[model samples]
Target: MSARFEELDWQPTDLGEISLRRRRDPSSGADVYEVKLDDDFLMSSLFTEGEVALARLGLAAASGDPLDVVVGGLGLGWTAEAAFQDPRVRSLLVVEALEPVIGWHERGLVPASARLVPDTRCRLVHGDFFALAEDPRGFDPDSAHRRFHAVLLDIDHSPRHVLRPGNAALYEPAGLRRLARHLHPGGVFALWSDDPPDERFLSALGEVFQDAEAHTVRFDNPVLGGTSANTVYTARTPQP
Candidate 1:
C-alpha cells in the first residue's frame, strides 16, 4: 500500500502557496491526489465528475470535427484528459497561471501527468487564463488572435466566488464578450463551478452567447455519505 499521506510538491507562487498531495483513501483503498491553494482545496481526484463533465458537455456543443480546444485550468489534468478522450479533438491548449502546476505534470507527479506529458496533441502553457482571454492575441502564443472550437474552464470556485478578485471580471458581460472574440462561430465555452447554478450568471452568458444553459453534475461523496453537485455552464457562439 502507498503511504498514508505524502505531499509530493509544494511551491510558493504569486497566487499563494500551492501544493500537491497524495493520500490513501481507506474506503476505496485507492490513492487520491489533491491540489490546494493555501488553505482552499482546489481539486481532488476523488471528485472529478464535474471537471470531466465540463469537457464532455462543452465539446458536445461544438459543431465541427477536428476540434481545437483551450482549457483554462490544469488542476490534476482531469479536464484535459477528458477532452483528449474525444477523438475529434485535434489539439488542446491548457492555460495555467502557476508554473509549478505545469511542472507537476511534466514531472509525472499526478496520475494523468504521464499520459498528458507525452501527448503531442497537448500543450501546457504557463500564463494567466483570464488575462489571455481578454487579450486580442488570445490563448495561442505563436498564433495571434487564434480561435478555438471550445474553451473549457475550471479555474474559479464560481462566477461570484473567485480565487482572485480580478478573475471576477471574466464572468461579467464585458469580459464574456472579450472571450467570445477568441471563438469561431458556433464554438462553445464551458465553465465548472463548485456552487449551484447561478441564474444571474446565466443571464450574463445569454447576453454574450446563444443557447446558454447550466448543467448540474452530481456525484457520490463517500466522505459526506451523500451526493454532491457542481454546476457546468455551457454557451455557444452564434452560428452564421
Candidate 2:
C-alpha cells in the first residue's frame, strides 16, 4: 500500500510561508518528505545525495582528530545527521534562519530530526547565517573565540541564485572573507549548489581560500526518470 500524502507542518517567516509535507513518490513508490519555502521546493528527502555529500566532502577536508563543524542550513536535518556519521566530529552547530524549520526538527516531524536530537554532538541555532558569518563574533554566541573545522552551507540554491537579496553578498569577495574568519587554519568551507559545477564561483572561492574545488554529486531522480546532479563547492582555508 502506498503512503497517503499530507501536510505535516506550516508556518510564516520573514522570508515567506514555509511548509513540510510527506507523500508517496508515484514513480518509485517510496515515502518522501519535502520542505517548501513560499512556492519554491527547498528540499526533498527523495533526493538528498547532495545534502549528504555536503557534509561528507566538507569533513574530508579537515585533518584534525576532533572536528568542530557548523552547518548553515537545516531544511530536513539530513546534512547535520550525516555530519555525525563521522566519528571524528566532536561538535556540530547547525545555524538556521527560519524558526519553523528548526522547530520541525525539535518536534520530530522530520525523519533525520529524530537522529539529530538524540545525538549529543549536535545543536541547532536559530539565527541568520549571513549575519553571523559577517559578524566578527562568529556563529557561536557562547564562545566567541571558537573556530570551526568546517562550515557546510546549503541555504541558498547557488551563488548565481539566492532566495534573498542580502544573500547575494555571501558569495562575493568581501563576504567570503568574513566567512573565512570563522574557520580555523586549513579548515573547510563547503556549500551545496543546485546547479552543476560553476567555474566562476570556484574562481571567486579560490581568491579567498588556499584550495577550492567543486564536487558533482549525481543521483537518480525518479520523478524525472533520469539522473540529476548538484555541486558541492569545497574550499580550504590557508594554513599558518
Candidate 3:
C-alpha cells in the first residue's frame, strides 16, 4: 500500500524548537515517525513513490542480472522493501544513522522495514552513511556493501534537506564525485528528495557524473485531495 496516511494520533513537540510530530500506530507502535513542520510526516511504516522510484532506477542501471544494492538510510524500510522486491537484487544493505529507528523496525512496529530486516540477504550497517562512504579502502571486496551495483540514498528530504548540517555534503560536488568512484560501470545512483530540488544540486550532479536526469513524481494521498510532490535525481556511472 502507498504511504498516504498521516498519524493524527500524534502530539506536538519541539525538536529544539523546530516543531515536530511523532506518528503513533499500535500496529506499527509508537515512536515510529518524526514529522517536521507538523503538516507532513517525514518517515513512516508505509512506502511512498519517491522510495519506490529509487529502487526502480537502481535496478534498471545494473548491467548484471542480479544486483547488489547499498541503501543509505532505512526509514520505515519503504525504500529497502521496494528495491528488494526485484528478483535481480542479490543483496541489500540498509545503513541507518538512528539506532532508535532500527529498534522500532526490529520490534515489528513498521511492517515494510520489519519484513525486509529478516531476509538473509539483508544486512544492517548501524552507523552514519558518511563513515561508510569515506572508508572505501576499509570495505571488503566480497562483502555485500563493496559489491553493490547500485547505491540508493534516501537520507534526507532532498539536497535541500538539512536535518543535520553535515548532511549537506552528500549533495556537494565533491561528495557526489566520491560516489561516482564507488559504483560499478553502468551502475546507478538514485536519490530521493522531499521536494523539487534547486538548480545548484542538479548542476553539481551534472558536474560529477554523466547522463543525469531528474524526475518529478507524486504520490496519491487520501488525506490530501491532490498529491505530495518530490524529485528523484538519477545519475549513471560509465560502463567500461
Candidate 4:
C-alpha cells in the first residue's frame, strides 16, 4: 500500500525541491526508487532501458577507442554507470546541476550509488550542464577546454519539453554549435527523450553533426499496460 512508502531524502534546489523516495510500484508489485523535482517525477528505477541506452548508443556510435565521456545529468546514475560497461570508456565525467542529486550518489542513497562511488574512472562535477556546455572552459572547471569522445545527456524530457527555461537554448543551433566544440573529432552526442523521436530535433541534429538517428528503446510499462518507449538520439561530429 502507499502508506508503507518512505521519503528517503529531500532538499531544496534552485530549480525546485528535489525528493528521493521508495514506494511500491503497483504495476510491478515491487518497491522502486523515485527521484522527483518538486511535484514532477524526474526518474524512476522501474524504467531505465532508455537511460542505459543513452550511454551505450552514444559510446558505440563514437569513432575512437579508449573513449572519454561526459554525461549531462546524474539522475539515478543509470546512464553514468552504463557508460562503464564499455571497456573503451577510459574516463567519465558527470555534470549535474543539482547538488542534492550528487549528494544522493555520494551518500550511497541511490540505486546505482555503489557502482558510481567506487569507480575510479568516474567523476562527478557539480555544475549546470547548459552553462558548462556554453562555457569556453567546458565541463570541468579545473581542466579547461577538455573534449570527450562521447557526450550523453538525459536532462530534459525532450527538446521542446525542458526542465527549466534556460535549458531550451541547449536544443537550439547556437547552443548545439557550442556543445560541438567540446567534442573530439567525430565524437558522439547522445540524448534520451521520454517522448518518441522528434523529427524536427533530429533534423536539427543532422544539420549540426555528421550522422544522426533516433533509436527507439522499448520496455514493458506495467502500470500503463502494453508497452512504452523512449528515444535515444545519437549523432557524430565531423571527422577532422
Candidate 5:
C-alpha cells in the first residue's frame, strides 16, 4: 500500500502550472494517477475509455497494414499504449507540449510508461501538437512532410472549448485542410472530446475529408456514480 495522496511531479510551463498526482481510491482500493493544468483537471487514470477508444477507432478506420501513427497528447500514456495494442502500428510518434509529461513516462512515474518506454515502435517527442499539425514539416522532426496512417488527438476539451484559444484554429476548416496534408490518402484523424458530438465540427470535417463520424463512448463514472460519455470524432482522407 502507498500513501493516501502523493504528487509525483510538478512543473511550470508556458501553458500553466502542470502537476501529476497519485491517490488511493478508497472504494476501489487502487491507486489513481491524475494530471492537472492549474486548477483544471486534464486527465485521470480512472476514466481512460475515451482515450483508448480514440486510438482504437482511429486505427480501425485506417486501411493499411504496418500503419504509422501520430498521437497528439501524452496524458497518462493511455492513448499511445492503446495504439501499440494493434500489431499493425509500425511506429508511434506522440507529440506533447509539456516536457514534464514526457519525463514522467521516461522516468517510469506512470504505469503505462513501463509498457510504452520499452517499446521500440514508440517515440515520445516534446513539442506543441497544434503547431506541428499546422507545419508542413509535420510531427516528425527528422523527416519533413512525413505522412502517417492515423493521427489521434486528445489535447483540447472540444472543438469549441479549447485549453488555449489558439488551439481553436485546428478545429476550423482551414486548419483541418492543413492537417489533412500530413495524412496519406485514406488515412484517419481521430479526436477525443469531453463534450458531446458537435455537428458544426462534423460539418467542418466533412469539408476536409471524404468521410467523418462521431462515436459516443460511455463508461461508468465511479466518482459521480452514473455513467459519463465522451465523444470521439474520426475523419478519413480521400482515397485515390
Candidate 6:
C-alpha cells in the first residue's frame, strides 16, 4: 500500500517539506496525525497523548521546586508548549536535530508551534538531543545550575519506527545512564514510543535507573489521523 492516500473526512496540513494528515476513529474519533517527511509517512501524532501525559507527569513531579527542563524532539511543539504552561518551570531547553522540522515551527506550520510557547525562559538549541542531555559543559552547579526536573524525549517512532538509524543509541544502556546522571534527584525521565513490546527497552531502563515503569495509553494517530494505543516509559532519578 502507498504511504499516504486521500481520506474523505480529515484535515490536511502542508508545512514546507512535510505534510500532516489527521483523521479520527468513528467510535471515539480520537485524534492522530501522520507526519510525511518529503513523501514518506514518518510518524504519527496520535502518540502526542503519551507525550502530553508525560509532560503532565513532569509538571506535577517538579511542581514544588523551580524546574529546569530538557525536552528532546520538538514535534509540533506540543510537549514543549505544555511544559511551558507550568509556572513551576523556570527554564526550558529544547533540542531538535532536524532543521526542516524546526523551520516548520518558525514558519508557523502548526499554530501552537508557530513560536507561540512564549515564556521568555526558553533556550532553543539545534543539536543531537542525546548529546545535550548529558553535556557536563552545560551544567554548572556553582553559578546558575543546569539541573533538570524533567527530561521528556520523543525521538524515532517510539522505538518501533526507528527510521533515523541514529536514534537506537539513545535507547541503549549508555544513553539511559547518561540521562539519569544529569537528572536532578526525584527528577522525571519519560519516553514516548509506539506500541508496547520489545522487552529490550524495559531492560535498558532497568540497567541504568533505580525504578522503571511503563504505562500503556491510547492515543490519536495524527498520521492515520485516528485513535491508537502506545507506551510511555517513565523513570525516576536518585536524589542527593
lDDT of each: 0.95, 0.91, 0.70, 0.90, 0.95, 0.67
Report the lDDT tens digits of candidate 5 across residue range 117-185.
999999999999999989999999989999999999999999999989999999999999999999999
In model 3, which residue pairs have backbone atoms overlapping below 3 Å?
25-29, 157-194
- How far in Å is the alpha carbon of 75 misplaced in model 6? 1.6
Candidate 3, residues 164-218, lDDT tens digits: the string is 7877886898887677767878778888888776688879888877778888877
Q: Candidate 6, residues 57-175: lDDT per residue as tens digits?
A: 65665534688888888767778888867877888887877665666666664555645445487666667775665566443323243667788887666765665666677788886
Candidate 6: count of backbone clashes, pairs at least 3 residues apart or interchain:
13
Against the true structure, candidate 6 reaches a TM-score of: 0.74
Off by over 4 Å in 6: 1-34, 43-47, 62-64, 114-117, 138-145, 220-227
lDDT minimum window of 10 residues, candidate 5: 156-165
How far does residue 81 in candidate 4 sit from its true spot (Å)?
Answer: 0.7
Per-residue accuracy of model 4 over 44-91 as CA lDDT, tens digit each: 998989999998898889877889999999989999999999999899
How many Å off is the CA of 187 in candidate 4?
0.2
Query: Candidate 4's error at 133, in angstroms?
Result: 0.5
